[model samples]
Target: MRIDAAIDAFVRQLTVDRGLSEQTARAYRGDLVDLAAFAEEAGVTEAEAIDLELLRDWQWHVSDRLAKSSLARRTAAVRGFTAWLARTGAAAGDAGARLRAPKSDKHLPRVLDRSQLDVLFARLEGRAAGDDPVAIRDLAIVELLYASAIRVSELVGLELGDVDRTRLMVRVLGKGGKERVVPFGVPAARALDRYLGAGRPALLRDGIDALLLDTLFLGARGAPLTARTVYQLVASLLADLPGSGPAGPHTFRHTAATHLLDGGADLRAVQELLGHASLATTQIYTHVSAERLKAAYATAHPRA
Candidate 1:
C-alpha cells in the first residue's frame, strides 16, 4: 500500500477502533502528513519503501526545527501509525516503535500569586464596561478563567445549559468526554451572569447556543471564541501586568489550585474541583501552599 493509503487506514483505525477524539486524530493526521511530505520529497511513495535510514533522516531534520514536545507528539503519532500498519499486514514490522524523543526540560507550570491575580482582575474590571461587546466578553473570559481554573478547551466548550446560575456551578465536559460540575464564587458567577445576560446577547446572531455565545467575547467577525484566541487574549493582557511567569489559562488553573489550598481547601477537594485524573497531579499545589507558608514564617518570625 502507498504511504498515504496507510495513513488513511491508520486514521480510520484511530477514529473507529481506538475511539480517539477528533482532536487526537487530527494531530495524528498532521504528523503523518508531514512524514508523507518528507517521503515524497525523498521519492519514496510506498509504505514498504521506507526504512530505518529514512526515518532517522526525518527525525534529524525535525530535531533542529521543532520543539521537544512537538517532536514527542509527532513521534507518538508515527509510532501508533506504524504499529497499526504492521499489525494490519501493510508493513512487515513496526519500524517506528523504537523511535525515541529528545529529553525536554521539566518546567513547572506557572501560578499567579494572590496579589498578582488581584491586579489582573482589577485591570480586567477596569476594562469591563463599554458599549463594545468584545470588551465585556474579554473581561468575563479572564474572570471565569481565574475564578474557575478550567482548561482553555473546556472554557470554549461551554454551552448555555451547562451553567446553573442559581447554584453557581458550571458543568464541564473534561478529558475523555466525562462530565463534571464545578462551582465558582459569587464574583465569578456575577461576571458570568453579566457576560451571558448583557454581553453574549449583544453578539449572538440567529443560531448560537454557547453560553458565552459569539462572545463572552467575540472575534472581529463576531464569531465564537477559540482556544488560541483565548490564549492570545490572556498573554496580551498579562503583558502589562507586573511580575514574570508563564501567562495563559493554565496559569490561572495553577493559581486557582494553589489559592484553594492556601484558603484551607482540602487537597482532595481541590483535586475533584480541578478534575485532576490523580491526586498526585493535584499534590503539586500543596507544595506551592507550603512554600507560601514558609515565606510568611520567615518574614514575620523574629526568633533566631
Candidate 2:
C-alpha cells in the first residue's frame, strides 16, 4: 500500500477500533501525513519502502522547527503507524520502532485560588441574573466544567437529554467513548436550569434548524458550540488572572480536581469523575495539593 493509503487505514483503525477521540486521531493523521510527504520527497511512497533512515530524517527535518512536545508527538505518531503497518503486513518491518522523541517539558497545571474562583463566579452570577443569554450560557459552561471536572470535549458533546437534573448529575461521553455519570453541585444545576430555560430559547429565536437540534450548548447563531469557541471563552476568562499555564478548559479541570482534594474528596472518586484511565494521572492533583500546603505553611510559620 502507498504510505498515504496506509496512513488513512491506520487512522481509521484508530477512530473505529481503538475508539480514540476524533481530535486525537486527527493529530495522528496530521503527523503521519507529514511523514508520508517526507517519504514521497525521498522517492519512497510505498509502505514497504519505508526505512528507519527515512523516519529519522523526517524527525530531524522538523526537529528544528517544532516544539519539543510537538516533535515528541510526531515521533510517537510515526512509531505507532509503522508498527501498525508491520502488524498488518503493509510493511516488512517497523521502520520507526527505534525512533526517539525529544523529552517534553513537564509543567504542573495552573490552578485557581479559592478567592479567585469566588470573585469570578460572583461576577458571572450577577451578570447571569440580568437575563443576558450569552452570560447565562457562559456561567453554565464554566459551572459545568468546574463542577463536574469533565473535559470541554465532553461538555460540548452534551445533548439536552444527557443532563439528569433530578439527580444533579450528567452523563458524559468521555474519551474512548466511555460513558460516566458525573455529579454537579446545586449552584451548577441552578445555572444550567436558567440557561436551558431562558438563554437557550433566546438563542434559538434568532435561528433554529436541524444542525442546532438537540445540542446542549449553542453558539452565537444557535449552532452547536465548537471547541474553539469554548477555548476562546476560557482564554478570555483567565486573561487577567495571575499564574501561568494553558488558559484553556483543562485549567478548570485541574482547578476542580485540586479544589475537590482540598475539600477532602476521595482520590479514587475524583479519578472516576475526571474519567482518567489511570490513578497515576489523578495523583498529580495530590502533588498540587501538597505544594499548596507547603506554600501556606511557609507563609504562616513564624520560625521560617
Candidate 3:
C-alpha cells in the first residue's frame, strides 16, 4: 500500500481501535506524514519499499529542525507505524524496528503556590462579579480547572450531563477514552452553579449549535469552548505571573497535583484523581513536593 494511505488507515485504527485521543492520533499522523515525505524522496513510495535506512535518514533530516522531545516522538511514531504495517501485511518488515532517538530531557512541571492561586482566584472572582458573560465563564473555567486538575481538552469536552453538581464531581473521558470521576470543592461547585444559572444562558442563543448546547463551557459566540480558547484564557492569566515553563492550562494541572500532594494526599489516590494510566507518570508530583520541602527548609532554617 502507498505510505500515505497506510498512514491514514493506521491513524484511523489508532482512534477507533486503540482509543487514542484525536489530538494524539493527529500528532502521530503528522509524524507519519513527515516520514512519508522523506521516504518518497528516498524512492520509497510504497510501505514495502521503506527500510531502516530510510527511517534513519528521516531522523537525520529532522535533527536540525526539531527538538529532542519532538524527535523522540517522531521516532516513536514511525516505530509504531512500521510495526502496524508489518502486522497488517502492508509492509514486508518493520522498517523502523531499529529506529532510535535521543532521550528527551525530563523537566519538572511548573507549579503555583497557594498564595499565587489565591491571587489568581481572587482576580477571577472579582471580574466574574461583572455583567459580562465571558468573564463569568472564564471564572468558572478557572475554578473547574484548578479544582479538578483536568486537561483542557477534557474540560472543554464536558457536557451538561457530565457534571454532577450535587455530588460536586465531574465525569471526564480522558486520554484513551478512559472515563474517570474527579471531585471538586465547594468553590468550584458554586462557580459552576453561577455559570449555569446566569453566565451560560446570557452567552447562549436560541438554536445554538448542538455541541455548544450540550457542552458545559461555551465561547463568547455560544459555540463550544475549544482547547485553544482555554489556552488563551490561561495564558492571559499567567502572563504576568513568574514562571519558567509554559503557562498553559497544564500549569493548573501541575499546580493542583502538587498542591494535593502538599496537603497530604496519598500518591495512589492522586494518580486516580489525575486519571494517570501509570503510577510512574504520577510520581513526578512527588519530586515537586520534595523540591518544595527543600525550598521551605532552606527559607526557614537560618543555619549555614
For all candidates, what are the clash counts?
Answer: 1, 0, 0
| Model 3 lDDT at residue 148 | 96
- Runs of candidate 3 exceeding 4 Å displacement: none
Q: After best superposition, candidate 3 residue 261: deviation in angstroms?
A: 0.7
Candidate 2 C-alpha lDDT tens digits along 6-113:
888999999999999989999999998898888898999899999998888999999999999999989988999989999999988888889899799877899999
| Whole-model lDDT values for every prediction | 0.80, 0.92, 0.91
Best by TM-score: 3
TM-score quality measure for candidate 2: 0.96
Residue-wise C-alpha lDDT for candidate 3, range 110-189, written one tens digit per residue: 99998888889988999999778998899999999999999998999999999999889899999888899999999999
Angstrom error of the Cα, residue 276, model 1: value is 3.1
Against the hidden true structure, what lDDT does model 2 obtain? 0.92
**TM-score of each predicted structure versus truth:** 0.85, 0.96, 0.97
Candidate 1 lDDT, tens digit per residue, 1-304? 9999888988988878767767878888999999999989999999977776788788888889998878888888888777887888888888887878887665556767767777877877877776666777887787777778788888987877777889988888777677799887888888877877777777776665554452334554557678899989889877876756687778889888888888889989999988989999899888877877887899999971
The parts of candidate 1 lying over 4 Å away from their true place are: 17-19, 206-221, 243-245, 286-304
